[model samples]
Target: MHHDLVDGVPVIWTETPGPLEATLMFGCGLKDETFRTLGVTHLVEHLAMSTLPRLHFDHNASVSLSITDFTCTGRPEQVVDFLARVCAALTALPLERIEQEAGVLAAEGSGVADPVTAELLSIRYGTQGLGLASFNGPGADRIPLDAVRETVARHFHAGNAVLALTGPPPEGLRLPLPPGPRTARAPHPAPRTTRSSWHRADVPGPGLLLSCSLDDQAMLLAAHVLSQRLTDTARHQLGLSYDVDGTAVFVGPGRGERSIQLDVREGQEQRVAELLWHEAVRLATEEPTEAELADEREAAREFLTDPRTADLEVAERAADLLFGETHLDGETKLALQAEVTPAQVREAFAAAMETALLLVPCGVERLTLGRPDGSALPAGGCSERTALPVGSQYRPPLLARARSGAARKVRLVVNADGAWWQDEEGLIHGFPFTEVVGVEVQEGGRMLQGLGNCFVPVASELFAGLGRAIATIDAAVPEALCYPASALRATG
Candidate 1:
């Protein structure tokens, strides 16, 4: 079921029955100002999530060259409460606060300064307004907070917002929608059209980045075919790892670009570069084998058919909607991929090999070929420590002591006041209680928190028995318990 509320900021609510999960997605078309607002909005979102109560999870946000989104997931029943809190936060968030807004913008600028790829991107798209290094450049440090806040306040008005909901809908959840159909600003036009080409710049080393630009709509299908064919050929035929991947960027209406990058290891630069060029030329000249084309088609079909693969599709669809591009549906995307001939693939590749090429090599002291320095920053840095708090730990209790086949359940009270856990699945689930100690845990990251109560249930009969025994002992002597604490802690 889906419901739309029409009033101010456009909002839509969707409901489905399954596991209790909720996602709030906000979309705004990308612009220099939009990106600036997104940086501030992102920080504001963090502040809201950090301050909200009964929040099982924190919100996550992403900003792209085209759009920005902020999303959060939680229990279905908490949807209304969460939405209310979010709406309140958005409404009350101070855009006039220069210090806070400038801080976020400065941090955003610092993050992009040293990325060589980003520098290359800036150079490639430099002529386009899209090439601006950031929404706010490094000069953001000089922007007064009040001016930044005023800019944010103006940019965040109803005309530029869309609120979308997914998952089982809560009862009587209310949302504010736009007054009517909202029109978005048209995306910047592509530099040129229908010209197939490739160009390369020699870097000081043997690394290579190959990029090809096409119309966004057509490139979507082309990318699917190219990705699948390259992966299969590289891994099975050439004995290479599947880790070689490329990036696809939506440039504008009839234009997008895709690039395949590889870092040549020591002594293999020439061979690898020659092989890559030959492959590109061959792909442009010859048709893929029928069996190979069929396999790629199957991969494309599976990709469109699978829900897990739908995230990128959903994001693209939203982007297209915002940009006024073709309304590409799943069926249309799949049909296009299925019908794409090997000749078309060759033609696309042939054209792409001509436009622009970038090769970069790092770590080597010298090269026979005279190439410009492409290494932007120092090649190595310290690994980021996990966010888990220092000295905190966790240990799963032994469960083999009870009868192996017996069915039992035990509840655990997680006292993770300021700690977090990385489940086996690698998700960083958090618990904010300072001293919660009684809770039931279900499978996965699901748990219930009561007043001074948080429960995790264990179902392995033996483990359940052990937990039960521990619960009893702890009940009798509460301070004698010893166990590994949570691993997540805040760090500077």
Candidate 2:
């Protein structure tokens, strides 16, 4: 591989025989967006691509959790033309067409990760940063014009981008993005939960997420082995599932979230969910055979040594430079994986699972998972208390209480410097007003999103006589932390 610079943008390149494959990467994506401006990154990407003249080439662009890329495979001149047009579009975005592009974006739907995996991120990181992956963010049209300009100024610039090519830089290639210094990203919010547990979501099947070092070779290989085991048992052996998808997204330097999601056959959701947990725990406590480990190593060898993957390797290097990740060449990475023993894989997977989450679909009931200590994995969500704290409390309006006994049991407390609610489920949810990151302003009341994915609703319909609590919140929180709910948001 070789490295150079094109008009101030870092260029990482390599030799390959196929039509030149080029990818221009920027160091920002969904992780950089706010709930109010959730689809802004996609909007920026779309706005750029929309300006490109019709071309007969396999070119496309995408936004992921932490980065975005514009890629194409074509003749050298086509590569040059594509990158130039993309850069020019960014430098002079056609904001007049934002409404047109917003419609396209909403129709395109979410594809960054599968449904189960995306929701798990939200369950782990609240409603911002990586957690934004699960939300549509009001709507694309709601993304402010100022936000677009700021994103371009902050991200799509020479200092924040890298150009990776399957072949050497094409003749006359140029990157004319705006001039700006590389921006540093704040670390993502701390995880909402860090122990063995389970949660339910709208999904086809179940998934397991493990937080670990990005370069943990053993756990990486172990996750691969578990995927194989699940595929073998669930797909081929029991016929309970049709496919198992896996994803590994880096969240910080030397840290990432790895997951395996399986698709359940009809009437088999519960069985598939149980199978996922059983396979994960089984692999953690029992090491895979030497033969099984060899299969994964050989697969790695094929992938790393393939000439067709040269462009991918280069793109990965670009991400490394952008994110400050420790870059290991193909051979070095393989060498590290080769030294990992079965016992090492077992121990690593076991330790990682101690801080893992099992996500099952919402309709599947009676599903149970246990910690290594044999106790049931606690249900995961915002609730940390079974009862409300003593405070000046509010309750449902008389009409609601008279109509529904469950409403009678609900209590909304707003004293002791914060507000909380004990729902009919009898679980308390909320944070101190100071810890509240965002208070989504609704017509009837405010919905607060804060620590541990807690969203407490102080609304007129649910709890009456909240004027004092609302006033207390207004006095305590920064004015900047409050915003009206998105126009496209579902009626609360």
Regions more than 4 Å wrong, model 1: 1-3, 6-54, 95-120, 127-129, 133-136, 175-242, 263-274, 309-316, 362-492
How high is each candidate's TM-score? 0.57, 0.92
Residues 113-230 of candidate 2 have per-residue lDDT tens digits of 7788788888888777887777765577667788899998999999899888888898999998887888777887788778888988888889988889868889889988999999
Q: After best superposition, candidate 1 residue 139: deviation in angstroms?
A: 6.3
Which pairs clash in model 2? Answer: none
lDDT of each: 0.43, 0.85
Highest TM-score, which number? 2
Relative to the true structure, candidate 2 has a C-alpha RMSD (angstroms) of 2.5
Candidate 1, 1-492: lDDT as tens digits: 233443354444434333333334443323343221224434444444444665566555554554555566666556666665655655565444544544554554443222333333443443123443222321333333443455335444445554555543457564442232344455554333122222233332222223454443233444445555545655566654334555655666556556555544456544444444445545556666667667666766787677664444544544454455676666876677667677776666655644434334333333232112222212111112244444234434444324322222222333423334443333333333423222232232222221111122223331333344334333432231222221221235
